[model samples]
Target: MKIRHLRNATALLTLGEHRLLIDPMLARPGSIPGFKFFGGGRRPNPLVPLPPDTFSWLEEVTGVLVTHPHPDHLDTAGIRWIREHGLPVWTSRLDAPGLGKRGLTVHSLEDGALGMGVERIPVRHGRGLLAWLLGRVSSYYLAHPDEPSVYITSDAVLTEDLLEAVERLQPDVIIAPAGSANFGVGGDILFSVDELVTLVRRAPGGVVLNHLEALDHCPTTREGLRERMKAEGLLEKVLIPADGEELHFARPERARGPAAPGPGATQERERASLASGM
Candidate 1:
């Protein structure tokens, strides 16, 4: 499998013949409003533009995997592009209907949906009312017979149940949000640096960190994160890819059996549709 990191939370995941675009935010830089609402330092979002070769990459996308309906994850430009390309969109049950209303083909991203072993793991976008207002989001674990298994933790805070899922699944690669984003209040909405350290230590295989240096709210920088990882003796285990970079993974010698969706951290699939963080 090859994962081509495009931009913030947007990547082209290749599993065998499938090239699935994950959470596309295809807007030009500064088109979206700033996300940092307090404590100053707010600027128009998408701090940087997509890579020069982004259009070439999009031509190969067979489908899209949306983790949520947030603007940063799936903005207006991304929606229009998908429609123009006539591509199928796979997402959690909670997000499928809303995405379909936006005029894109939508399908459930559950186990057995895409000719692969898929598991939908629910996660908390933040704590207390912030999480509630952020609405429901999900992480996906995909296992293909000819490719390595991967767990994509779409925006989430640290939680015991999530760690348990990691321990249980033991995916070959883990792609997590490392932006440590906050609206300048209510603590961090994504994983803190310390939490990321802990997570790296626990991961059995390589861990790819994204969601950095692309948004106004996400304070984590790739250079700073790399230095911290080096300090923590995790440089070998973690990969902080630059925009437009790609990483390849092959199935290990000890591959596991077919993946089954766990009950996951949260079971309440029904929730309000408030994609608050724009």
Candidate 2:
């Protein structure tokens, strides 16, 4: 599978026959408002322009994935782009109705919706009242026969449920936001740098970190995250790709373990061991 970081949380996730555009905050530089609501570092979002080759790359997209309806995830520009291309959208069951309300043709992505294995893991946007304002977010674990399984943890704060999902899914790649974003009034709405380190350390396979340097609220730098991960003895398992960079994920070279018994058993057994290890 080829994963291209399009800027912010936006990406083109190419797996098998699908080139799924994930969370498109498509905007011309300086066209949108800034996100830093406190501590005074506000600047127009998407500090850079799309790569010169973006259009050629985007032309391969087969569909879209909307983890949430927030402007940063699925902005007005993103919506218009999808409509112009007439691309199909895969979203959570709850968000689908709302997207449909706005005239977007939607496809609900519940468990097994992909005709391959999949698990929908709902996540909290933040802590306390901040979470309420951030609204509900959905993360997904997709297992495709043609490629390594991947877990896309959309905008979210670290939580027991998320950790549990990570332990269970055992995805070959875990794509999570690593910005540690916060508005002045609230704390981090996504995983803090420390939390991301822990998440990367615990992942069964490779971890790809994104959501950095694109918005004002997310201040965690890739260098800082690397230092922490290296300190934690986990630099090998995690990847921090730059915007417009494309990475290919190959299946792990080692082989072990018997096939998991029955439906969901692979995930269930993995989760069970997580608690035992803790």
Candidate 3:
């Protein structure tokens, strides 16, 4: 599998024959309003533009995966691009109806939706009343039959359910947002640097961090995060790719030991927990 990190949470994820564009925020720099509501540094969003080669990579996208409808995740430019390309958008059931009303061809991402084992892992976007106001977000675990599995933890704050998903799935690659975003008053809407350290430590496979240095509200820098990870002896296990940088991972050879549970097993547990209010 290959993941090319674009600006913010947008990435070109190549798994098998599919090139899924994840959470595209395709806008010119400063085109959107600022997200930092409390702190003084309230500059317009998308502090930087897409890398020069972004259009070339975008041409390969076969589908779009939107974890939510936040403007930062899917802005006007991104929606326009998707409509022009006529690409299929795969998103959570909770978001399908609203997104469909906006005229994009939307599909709910369920188990086996894209010829892969899919699990929607819910996460908190903030704390307390702020979390409720930030709305719901879904992280996805996608496992293909002949490739390394990946878990895309969309914009979220640290949570027990997230940790549990990492521990249980042991995906080959885990992609997470590391912007450390805050509207200044609500504390943090995304993972703090400390939480990212812990999350990377808990992940058994490679961890890819994105959502850095793109928006004014995101304070974490890639260099700062790299230094922190290095101090924690976690530099080797993480990939803090620059915008437009692509990293590849091949499946590991199977061991001749007892077979582990199928990828669908964890999704079943997740669904049950959601149903029971656990």
Per-residue lDDT tens digits for candidate 1, residues 104-194, read 9999998877788988899999899899999998999898876778899999998997898889887778999999999998989999999
Q: Mind giving the per-residue lDDT tens digits that candidate 2 earns over 1-278? A: 77888788998987777789999888888888988877899998777776666767788888899999998899888899888899889999889999988767799986556565667888988899989887889998877665677889998878888888877667778899999988877788999888887788778877889998888888999898889888999887877877677777654444422111112111101111212221
Q: Write the per-residue lDDT of candidate 3 for residues 1-278, one digit (tens) a residue.
A: 78888889998988888999999899999999999988689999889988777887789999999999999999999999999999999999999999999899999999888888888999999899999998999999888776778899998888999999888877777889898998889698999999999998888788889999999899999999999999999988888877767777776676321113122111100111212221
Q: Which candidate gets the maximum lDDT versus the true structure?
A: 1
| Stretches of model 3 off by over 4 angstroms after superposition | 255-278
Q: Which number leads on TM-score?
A: 1
True-structure RMSD, every candidate: 8.2, 8.2, 8.8
TM-score of each: 0.92, 0.89, 0.91
lDDT for every model? 0.87, 0.79, 0.85
Point out where model 1 deviates above 4 Å. 260-278
Clashing residue pairs for model 1: none
Worst 10 residues of 1 by lDDT: 263-272
Better of 2 and 3 by TM-score: 3
Candidates ranked, most accurate by TM-score first? 1, 3, 2
